[model samples]
Target: MSLSSLRRQDAAVVRSSLALRPLALAVHMLAVGAAVTALPVYAAEPTEEAVTLDAVSITGEAEGGLSDVTEGTQSYTTRAAKTATPLKMSLRETPQSVTVVTQQRIQDQDLQTIADVVNNTVGVSLNRYETSRGQINARGFELNSLMIDGVPTIYEQPWSSGEIFGSLAMYDRVEVVRGANGLMTGAGDPSASLNMVRKRANSKELTGSVEVSAGTWDTYGTLGDLSMALNEEGTIRARLVGEYNDGDSWIDHHTNKRETFYGTMDIDLSEDTTLWFGASRQENNSDSPAWGGLPVWYSDGSETNWSRSTSMSTDWSKWDTTYESYFVNLEHTFANDWHAKLGYTRGERDGDSYLIYPFGSPDPVTGLMGGYGAGSYKTNTTQDDYYLQVDGPVELFGRSHDVAFGYTHSDQDFDADTRGYIPTANYDFNDFYDMPEPDWQPLTDSDASETTQKALYAATRINLADDLKVILGVRSTDYEKEQGNSKIKEDDEITPYAGIVYDLTENLSAYASYTDIFLPQSQHDINDNQLNPIVGESYETGLKAEFFDGRLNASAAVFRIKQDNLAESTGLFIPGKTPPTFAYEEGDGATSDGFELEINGELAPGWNLMAGYTQFDVEDADGEDVNTQYPTKMIRTFTTYRVPGFLGDKLTIGGGVNWQDSIYVYAANPSGVAEKVEQDAYALVNLMARYEITENLSAQLNANNVTDEKYMDFFEAYGAFTYGAPRSLTASAKYSF
Candidate 1:
């Protein structure tokens, strides 16, 4: 069957699914109601009692310390997090599945980029479309929300932007909350939210670290970090971080260079007030990068088996991009233990690229290929955002509860220009390495747009009893966008959130949550009118546990996500247009049902572990599978052990494996016959070893893809795919003062 036929069949399934939503929702609500009613039986009255215990004094532990920053913590888990809600709560209290990739984990796994982090994260997947661009997905939906210090930013699709290529040297940790996050993000997909916490100037004395490394394919890199108190009274502090990396790829003529710098300062305004500011810049340049990917089939109607090092790029092709950001925050604490914060951020992104895209397939025998297209493109984007939030404890029913209120406003502008050239003559596929550059035409305006968003949100965590707690929140958003002659605006869109957590025992708890988000669509219907925004609703229930004084965390969760008003193509094009546009219609949408199990933390005195398993199925109303390109089953795990008897407890060794089930896409072969292009299930093995040479110096080595597995990193319905990296190794040494 053709791709179009598959889509039509999926649409029919969607309609059928829609007809059953009312019944499904009714049943879900009834179940929640039954649980709420049964809570009284589990609640017990508190009684005063006296107990004797050993008294111990712990040194080097501060009161009300910074639990959000996991830089100095060697454990894989944290005591508490505020990513799911503004209020600080343990993982078991948030009523959502949360994962924190701490600094220790980043170093243990040698993760250098955000893409690397996501690929190793539980229940999350990274889809690499090209060398420098990719998408992040979870729960069978693309993730579009990114946050830094609780501030949100919307990134464009992977094909158009390089946002996912950001470096991780400036961040102390990454926090991910799976499911709908409309309360904090205001507008986005229901997949997941990723928040990166920046490292701060928290030291009172001079402290720093430096590291250098060299790896396979002539790759070398260096990193430096410094922090110190600038004032004699230790009231003002500053920190600086920088990194530089250059590497040659396994693919012929492909090379990458990256540079990053970040600086931050914190000033004490008074005994209860502080001002913080920071600036960061990152630049990435790639030479001879492929525009798309290699063809999946040859002209003879047989699958093509190109070498992993094959390339379809010319020597002159390059992609150069830069990201710069500035932010300021003021925070005040009251005598009542309440806090208020005001913040502002400005971000800018610039890109310049010259690329060539190969089309059609080559003859298997002669290696002759079809024509190619080339272009020179440039893009610039700028965003300014402001927000104010107040959060503290409130007295409700003679009990202390947490509540927060906030408002945010953002404005963004984008502009793009391109020059294009197409070659009519066919060339031999074997000659792609020496392909000639095309003479591009003069640059002209391609697209320009402006967007604005305003939102108001509030949340409150109410302590109903000693073992029961409930959280309720809501958000109202006003969004608008404008282009040359078109405008799309949505006002007063309301999103609601609710969750309940009940303690089952001292070490375990059970919870449930419901939330929703709205996404505006740019597609138009047959009437030439824009379609309604898509609405996503998510329901989840889970069990959570903490052991060894919160050193280890575990969670088991089940979730279902439903989307309404999804746009589907009508197989008809708008008439009288230079470039034809497809007409679409509103469909009932799709549903995803899944579950996740995760565990992270220290299992023993000198051992740390992080592991997770995820499985989900996505189907339309008619129960037909959709989004088949994304795997339905995945497992990610890593662990490290410090040998107490070996080298006087100075050596640590670790290893991990990441596995995903098979994925396939329907595409047309070179002979115009529809076929399934699939990638078999695969796993990548990684290993690491670190040795403490002295009290203040260490050496480490990391090996990735140890099995030398050959797999595709990305695949599309257009019969193009990108290959994953082969076995590689890196060794480094670091010194601290």
Candidate 2:
């Protein structure tokens, strides 16, 4: 069935569910009360008996641990991660460069959304297409690989139109792996993979937190999180998280409202078996979202210096979205010590926009802008994903090794429609605020696309020596895409992964890795034939170290990536099309070379620090810069220090600075002369402080862009610009038990 029909049914369901919410809440409260009353059954009277220890063996942690998946520490450093490989390994053991943003850091920075997280992450950048959607880039490449609880999923781009904007309250932490991840993500970019680890119901007792915040730009929000053991034996647990936000944008007539709900349950089926189920729903509604940013130039070939609040959107313009998801996962440990897992997830997202675009330079004589239009647009995307994997120890060649095998299947559908003549009217340039809203046309089905992918993967970690290890893996993928009358198929592309690590000392390791990339192409050649997919190789070498008994971590890495069969426009116009079409050819492809350095964790007893610096250069086959609008150099750092003995250890202070090199775009003027508009190097400074008012109450204040820097965070090749946020402040209070 069409997505529109499904949306109608879902809306009705939502209305009915709203009426049942009060009853549901009442039942939940009663259940909590009963559970609390039964807690005494598990509590024993003061025990007078003494216990004796049999053995004092201090065994090291295994590659995979239950605690690694359940609890995320607040420190800047983490001991183990599962993003690089299915098995959890120490950061020093992982060959690739990885970064983790823990829940504590998210709260300290007051990060509300994924965009905020990406912007603050080292070596990553954001490009806002509009207020409702944006893009993320790392290592000079667009990032498209996204995973939730290790299950691969694709996010709708450009429009975002989904839970991409949802609050981060539901996640334990965010992990990023730089470089190709073909072993885990079958078909994707060679740049980076982002994995969001969800919050689990692991608390054995009643524990929760509630927070409220008010910020500049009339932004205010509240969040509540609760977790508890469902029974006295603690065999079952449940957790729920909710958030609400209402805010006004820096642009005139722009406002945002968002709501999110997430819940999960964990059941211990047996001593060695477990089951998990989770569901979430989110809605993000905005009024007067920008179709694009402010124009860069006037018709007279002079630059336009507009205020940050200058908005080209009409009061009637809006972009609203809804997202929902459900998932289940099961795991069992065999008698032989091997572990097996099976998981599945289904997700749906829909959005509608009453949009207006004013896309031209003003008339030099009449000061009138003619490129105006309005339309009603609707889009929906759905995804179903499954995975099964098993890993255990096996003796080989007189040595113990760990091996893992897995299968994954994913199906995704996306569709969009639009109706009406946009810009029903145009007005003079200076009359933007007084311009009337255009009567939008009705919406109808326009186009649809679908893709399905299946893969089988396997990997092994060989302990070649006590201080040496090797990882070998491969994934065989079959992918298919259908768009209108065109169909593309790629059968069984084998991508390989290889890595080696050697302990340089007790606290550090030296490693190198090579990854094969496989990405399907959507571009067409001169004759309309689909271009061959991009096939590439990535190489990297790095040094990783741990300090203070794993409380601190650092890494330095250098890498290079090369891809072939890249689609490049020939700059020639075909005559038969309605207007004209540019022909494309599989050209020389592109290359990127870069290096990164990062250090994070506690520097001392009372101080915490996180710092990183990165630089890269990218060029197309012709040796021309591919994306000059992205900075070639960047440095970001932040640190916090606690006041000892003063104010009873209740006061903490922190600050950070983010700096980037100049970036520019090439555009043509009315006279057809190419000119460059550049945003010079700039830095943004931020300060934060927190104070505990009582045993269960605390307050924090955050000030961003303290320098009040004026700069463009995103610049389009065609002269559109998205300016960075100006100076703003937010203060929040929280209570926990």
Candidate 3:
């Protein structure tokens, strides 16, 4: 059945479910009352007795501990993060470069999606190839691993859509670790890893907020978040978050509607044991979504300058995506301070798109474009992941150290189909907006794939001296994949990690780390055999400092990365293939050298700041620049300052700027002449102001692209480009209890 038909069939069910929300809440309250009343009670006179017990020492901290929660911190940085390893450690002790975007920052910037976070994050960039899809990059490589509360999710570019558009409403913060992360993620690139920490049911009292906003391009949105204890003892708690948004884009005939819902429960079975479960769903539906972007050149081999509002999509075109995730976690703390956790996660993604791609270019005088084509595509992906981990303090040479052991298993299945169609007639560039939608053919199977990974890993943090520490880890991964007629298996692939840190002063530390990972490829060689996995190695050294009792942090780092057995296309199709396919070969690979500097946290009593600068150069073995589509130099910074005086104490103001160096791609023009399509260096400016109307009410205004910069947000070697969003404003009112 068609996705549209399915959506139609489910609409009524969804509406009915929504109508029962109040009844569901009533039932939950009743259940809580019943549980409270059923608690055992003993009313017996007891004789006075004295008991003596041995003193117990706690050794390790549990995952998602209070130290990692940034929701109530009101700061731009957290005190501790465990994304790089199972051991909870401060940023200065982690060895690798880590950046945390806290909840305060998210609200200040009005970041709604993961893409928005990435665009504002340090050392990260988003390649928004289309309106509904993007590729995240860092350190001259693509990031393929994403974690939700430490559970890994693998994303393949071809089959994944709207993953980057996941809603951030349910998250407390986003943690980014730069460089190879094989210690936790079994197989992936050396670029970086992202961990999204969810907001738990931490508040025992009924506390919540409601926000409503309106913005340019006919955008409106509402968000609500509620959290409270479900039992009198506060041992059981629950949280619910929901959002709805509808907007029209700067692009002609484009409209978008999105809905998100998330709920979680936390139950303290005992003083030392806790159970957590949550489920989330996000749906993004759009009309007239752009597919590949605008043609970059005219037929005369000259570059074409199109209006920012120009679009190749018809009114009937759309790209809709939905993501659902469910997770459960159990944690226990032993008498010796040891911590053990078991977790399971199920993730599903669905995408349905009917899009048009405009080909060729307009004639310089006639303004007539060559042609346009359309396709109806659908994809579904499901992943199941399970993990067990234990960590505790160990006595070594009479000194206490930390050690962690973990095992993980992940299974993913993906299927895609397409109903392809092509229009027979050409359309004028000026008349493209009136083009009619094409009739889509029946869907046919395009691809199907299954992947599984199992891994065991261990790490230890050893304290050699009062001022010196070292961390060592290793992982053994077993991976298997089945697609088409090809089956690939790799057993016992070992990845190693090492890091050392020395305190230079009470507030300063120096660190160095090394790690490596491998990436499997689907590309085939000339002999129709899949290529070996790419092996990546990263070496990094850095200095870190803290101030104001760890309330502020600063870091500077330099790094080098090398990848072996990288795939390079041969520009030739395999012989006797029904459908032409490009063959690939193992190349000499590439090397990337870079440096980064950053500062985050509160600079003063009412001032919060986050700023970073990044620069890198990557080259292939032939000494030619590679991955030119990504900027080699970037600066991202944002700050907020609340007024201090009596009259102005209720107001806050801030602004920021993001700048990137020029990027270019080589592609052939309509005339078949190879040319360079470039986007020069550009900077976007943003501003925000918030005022407290009362103790429980606040209003905020955010302006993005204040300068109205005209730039291409996306461009590739295919001679297509997308324009960035123009200046826009959003005003919101929020109420808190």
Clash pairs for candidate 1: 13-621, 13-622, 14-621, 17-621
- What residue runs in model 1 are displaced by over 4 Å at the alpha carbon? 1-69, 157-159, 422-424, 524-529, 569-584
Clashes of each: 4, 5, 1
Residue range 550-613, candidate 3, lDDT tens digits: 5677887788899898889999997876577889998878788878878887776678889898
Sort by TM-score, best first: what order?
1, 3, 2
Question: If scored against the real structure, what TM-score would every candidate get?
Answer: 0.90, 0.88, 0.89
User: Candidate 2 residues 1-737, lDDT tens each?
Assistant: 43334334433442343232323433443443343334223223332211110000001123344223114344766666777777546777888888887777888888888888787788887777567666677887877657887777763332456344567878877888888888888887777878887777766689999999999999999999998989998879899999999999888888999998999988888877778889998888999887776777788878888888878687778899887889998877788878888888998878888877776788756868756766678988899998899888898999988898999999999899987664444577666655676655677778788889999999989999999999999999999989887687889989999999998777667789998677887767777677877877788887777765565677777788887887788887644654566777887777878777787776665577788987777666655666667776789888988888989999989999999887767666655666667789899999999999998899999999999999885546557787778999999999998
Candidate with top TM-score is: 1
Deviation of model 3 at 269, angstroms: 0.4
Error of model 3, residue 537, in angstroms? 1.0
State residue 708's C-alpha deviation in candidate 3, in Å: 1.1
lDDT of 2 at 365: 62
Evaluation by lDDT, superior candidate among 2 and 3: 3
Residue 308, model 3, lDDT: 88
Model 3 whole-model lDDT (C-alpha atoms): 0.81
C-alpha lDDT of all candidate models, in order:
0.81, 0.76, 0.81
